[model samples]
Target: MTDVSKIFAPGGVLSQTIDGFQPRPAQQQMASAIAAMNDDAGVLVVEAETGTGKTFAYLAPALLAKTDDGERKKVIVSTGTKNLQEQLFHRDLPRIRDALAPDAIVALLKGRSNYLCIQRMDQFISQPIKHDPAVALQLQQQSRVVKYWANQTRSGDLGELTELAEDAIILPQITSTADNCLGRDCPAYADCYLVKARQEALEADVVVVNHHLFFADAVLKDTGFGELIPHADLVIFDEAHQVPDIASQYFSESISTRQLQDLAQDMRLLYGTELKDLRQLSTVADQLDKCGRDLRLQFARDPERGNWREQMRRAQVIEDSERLADTLDRAQAIAKAALGRNKVLDQCYERLVLLKARWQQLTNTQRSGYSFWYETTPRQLSVHQTPLSVAEKFTSYMLAQQMQWVFTSATLAVNGSFKHFTDRLGLGSAQTLVLPSPFDFAKQAMLFLPRYLPAASDPTMAASFAAIAKQLIAHNHGGTFLLFTSYRMLNQVAAILQEQESSDRLILVQGRTSKRELLDQFVDAGDAILLGTSSFWEGVDVRGDALRLVMIDKLPFAAPDDPLLQARIEDCRLRGQNPFQDVQIPQAVISLKQGAGRLIRDALDTGVLVVCDNRLVQKEYGQTFLASLPAMSRTRDIAQVTEFLSKD
Candidate 1:
């Protein structure tokens, strides 16, 4: 086998083939550790700090891994987001592959919904939409565009249609869900894009996917045509800090009004085409649809997530939910009556049974060790029964697979310890490593804890944050990221800055456009103040002069009232653990690390991180948060921050 160290050394294949490749001891160490683990089958949790070149470190070892018989080892690399998944598959993987093994086969597979279902699209085109005339016309035009693209697309991945809006109305109509997909029974089975992708993944030595799809497969084992992970010799999770929450989400059971609505719409479609003789199908389907919408109306119009146990205490909520259950029973009865008449209707019946069971489970607040919560959008409501901790479940699943597992992220350990992350996922026995970032942080960056800022909870906090931001933006002349823990604070500061900043300075806020577009605009403008919330905290990279200042509004703590957090707190209390120290502080520390990591992306990058919250200095637990961050020069003076920016 090729030496992993040689591949990452100064005079290595990577240095010779890849542009601007610099040798880093930490990167080589990480690659060597992973290569060593490839010979064994157990869990390894690594915290490869930002600028550690972790992607290449992990990729090199995986690309060269071999089985006992000298065959290439099968590996699955899962990322935290689709954007990173694409970046790895299309950009990073190819570079590593070319440098190490050009003949290696790799495949990128996303969730089933990302691929266009030809059967669903054909069904949609055959039927006329019953929406408002203007809306219907718009959807018709979008569908026409999709049809044209479908004819030309080989992958049928909707991401390839960059021209289409992410939230296009026609998307749900054309995509397939586990509940709606007919699988091998469909007319378009031979030309299915999802199946083709899975086939390629099955044959490839490396398969790249996102965390959501990975967990979906772990839970459902239905996302892939054949199970994808079980066949792999190794599995790696990047951005592994996100794994616990995402794994918990997949392990939970959820029932949504949109799902119920979709089932109704599908039944209605079947009634018009396949099972026209069943006149009662349309009535029950419409009733189910109305009940789902009526249940949604019982909740607040504003989008929010709340404890479902509390929600069910309301008489209107109970009454509406019971009505929904009754409607489901009627729909299931109708579906059962026409079971043998059509395969699609039979599938609908099976889906109805599962939905009914899930509804019952979600409504049962008596269940221990689970958090019952409901989230609402403008048009739908989804109730979930999430396990308080996925530690046992995840560990058992990992053990069952018996594959070499690696969990890595820039922000996994808290205060130089991996206990917080490892305990959450029950990887207590896993090997651990923490590699400091390759960048010289003390010289390249300054941590600014602005003095005399209002408390994070103060009503006037936004005003103080705006003042500090104004000062920093004036010093930096744009190229700033004012990251916030809450949208409320973000909007308030954005409003204040808009009124104060000069016309030539571009100010871009989140939610006005897609994250990708916002980032692209920020990079192109070279000097723009971008205000964003949680989404911009991490997985964002803007090296060089485009981003020289990052001001965090507050510590990125999970909201106290959040259902999952509340449940976890209660459970911790029962176990006689300090939820504040063990749970809240550690989670916040990791989050703060992620937010701070956005500043110094490269060794050549110099920046000032202005944390507007004074808690870092005033609170007793502040030292824990401080110890976890990079070794940067710290100050409480605004002048020092300005001076640092002036150097740029």
Candidate 2:
């Protein structure tokens, strides 16, 4: 076995090769612990706090592992987000591989949507323009840009095109979904980027993927095309705190009005180009499109997610669903009749059948052990049937795989117990490890709970939050993050601050640009205040003076109206447990920890975490939140907070 300690020790391989290297005891311990488990087939759950150098700790073992016969071991490292996935594959992995395992072959695999679909791009380029002249011209220009780049690109990963905006409309037109992809029948199948990426992953000794792709491929394995992720002897999950929710999403059965509409559009396109003689195809396609729209209209105008079981009880919902099913049956019949005429049509027929079955499954509320929920946008709606608990299914898969599993994250345990996470994932028997952050939190950070703040539920809370934010930003000069629980509150506070902006310090809002762009602007403009919601709370690292204050407007609690939370609460009650204590508090504690973790990211970093919620000090359950946080100096007086910030 390779000596991991030698690589992580003072003046070791990493230190000698990498600049600004400091030896951390916690990081070395974590690496050694993980290296010791590479020989066995058991689960290891680790809560390595911030600054633990967890990325290198896990990567070193996986890259250096060898089988009993002395062959290199295969490993899969899954991250919580695409950004992190790319970082690990493109930046971190190469550094570690060069230092220790220079021969290790590594690959990065993302979901199919991330890669450009050549067949779809060809179809999109050839399609006639039916939009307004100006709109058509814009699309034509965009298509030409994509065409030019497509010819020169090797990887065909859309992320390579940095000039294009993430929300570009041309992207959806060029990309293919599972329902629309022609698979082997596609003319571009031989050169398919997604296929090539998956093939590389299967051949590589190490593969990096995100949580969504891992679960998505797991679910797709039943369909026989889920070869995207190869079975590995060692599996490591970074940011594993996000696994339960992401796993639940994949395990659930869902059908969306957008998908139905897309099917109808595909049928119409086929009728226009391939099968001009199929008049019934166009008729049923139009009917299906109208039925989907009608069903969406039956829901409220404002976008929301609610209990699908309750919606099914309404007459209008039931009526529209029946009409949709009838239209789908008609479309399927037409598709079946023309199956032999076109491969795309045959695939469409199969999709119709699967979609109809999923629709039935989602509408059936009588099934126990599942939560039926529905969410709506301005023009689309999707229904889901999610299992209340993924523990049994997840556990069975882990046991059957017989691979050494490692789950590591900074925010997995709550109040020093892993029960909440372990129970949710059925990993109670797994060995657990918690390594405190190497940073001196007491000396580098302060927890400020402002006094006389409006309650989180009060209508004037946003105004009060804005007032406190103004004070903090004034003292800090603008290196501040005002995190909110909702967009409404964020916007309200943003408006109030905008009206009072008189300083040279810039104020950046979330929606004005992409997250990456916003962060860049905030960091570049050293004195800037950024107001954001959920996405800014975690997976954000701005060490040093760029970010010195993080003020959370409220405790990071799941909304009570959330259909999944409600379902879980009711299920807990039925099982004779305190849902508030068992489910809600733990979940909130994890979220709070994630939010607070934004502060003091490095040993030299210093910041003040100002949680505006008074409940942190006034309520009995507040102690749980406090205990889960880092051991920082506590203060309730605004004078202390301002004095601390002024010291910098």
Candidate 3:
């Protein structure tokens, strides 16, 4: 911090307002790592504790290197959630700039989904309406957000627009895509938000982007990473666990029917009242409509409403998606040759070709447990297929990178070893380090497992859950987070507690409200209980003792039904590896860490994380769960938990 202190000395490079926010030791180490990496390049893994000022550790280096004028260099920081992305862009990043270089330029970048494409919005608004209130609310909300965009938004990034529904159609409405962007020639080109945001990021010294977009830039669409990396000196990945997954997504292929429909809709909209393009576009749309109807007529149920694999009639649907994209690609060539220099026509043609190419890739690509499939309902549709084993490719990307690579999270190591995740990402011999949290976890938190609770297979798991919820929460009777892996289990837990015991206060479930709203209620609980899923796992913060008990129903394993997991596991087996040990357990360890992390959010936060699964004692893998967690004191006794809460 002496170096940081000098930087803040009288008329120092860093400004006066940020003088008080000196670098903590962890922050300095992070900064030092980035600085060293500017000239050096093995790999760095940082385990920054919560109060360790990790944000500043990386941000300061990105800022300092920019002091030299006109180099066109930057640092890319990727976080895991939109909330964290927002916090950094709107809060932390600005504070660091004020403390270090008040005049520095910065910007936040997100995926296309988070921005509004006014051209797309106009098309949706003009179309015939849907009757659902949520749908209506989403459309109306999109209009309001775009209205906000014209003035307060320069880049038109929706993260700048604070108020909107999570499911709003408006967000998807406004963002540009490879399918719809007319480049510099579209009617909305001057007003295009996505392009504008990217333009600004190209000029800014520090760019705050998410892992998805960062990896997408680095791999899938090489042009995106090219915009900054050619000039960038360093890159920081926060919530780095998500990096491997994001990298895999970009390096691999995905194509969907919904992708076709969206592009088709855009073409029709751009074509407008012109009867020729409409006739052509509508022909494609009608074909897709028939595909949906055929699948529905055969299955008699929407694939999305339940298990899609049960709908054996999808072979035709998959074939049709490929045929449609290919047919459109041919039509696009004719249109491009005939239309010649017309900007809108050229864009429509390019979009048609791109859509077709992606769809073709989806249909042809084959991997273990993978198939060309469509997820469809009368109202919703997505057509895509994904490969099971992306680990080989993910590891190659990491190993190939020339920059200093750091992967850190609260739970990277399972059972006192980082091998699980390291091996999964293909990091064979990379240097690894571990830092047990400085927090006296045993003194600040406790682990409670109900010995009497029935096993997952027991017919009375719900009843056992209610008894456990009552025991842990009834004593404190204020704030608690009941975490479950599934809506079925969450609903069961909700029913058990709501029907069997009376809290006489608000009990909010995940579906009833957004995760953000639920966390708010939990924080402000007069006697509030929040029931949430993995979305609530890591990003949540309920400080002090307001949040007292975090009851988990099962150790979160990848949903056994997920096509992605099924595909990956099969690929692992072909290589003669234990999928349970290599894939499932590591994935679950990260999730458990996220859920268990809900308890000790702040240094002062005092709560008990009750694992309803007694397997912590029964299963060998349970030891991994215990070791990955903060070093909290443990006990299976209910009496000890009750006694601990008595201090309140």
Q: Which window of 10 residues has the lowest lDDT sum in candidate 2?
A: 219-228
lDDT by candidate, in order shown: 0.88, 0.88, 0.67
List, residue by residue over 377-445, the lDDT tens digit for candidate 3.
665555455555566776665556655566666657777776666665676665665544546678888
Candidate 1 clash figure, as a count = 0
TM-score of each: 0.97, 0.97, 0.86
Can you rank all candidates by TM-score, best first? 1, 2, 3
Q: Give me the displacement of residue 500 in model 1, in angstroms.
A: 1.5
Per-residue CA lDDT of candidate 1, range 363-399, in tens?
8788789889999999989999988888899988877
As for model 1, its CA RMSD to the true structure in angstroms is: 1.5
Candidate 3 similarity to native, TM-score: 0.86
Q: Which ten residues in a row have the lowest lDDT in candidate 3?
A: 222-231
How accurate locally is residue 336 in candidate 1, as Cα lDDT from 0 to 100?
Answer: 88
Tell me how many clashing residue pairs each candidate has.
0, 0, 6
CA lDDT for candidate 3: 0.67
Which of 2 and 3 is ahead in TM-score?
A: 2
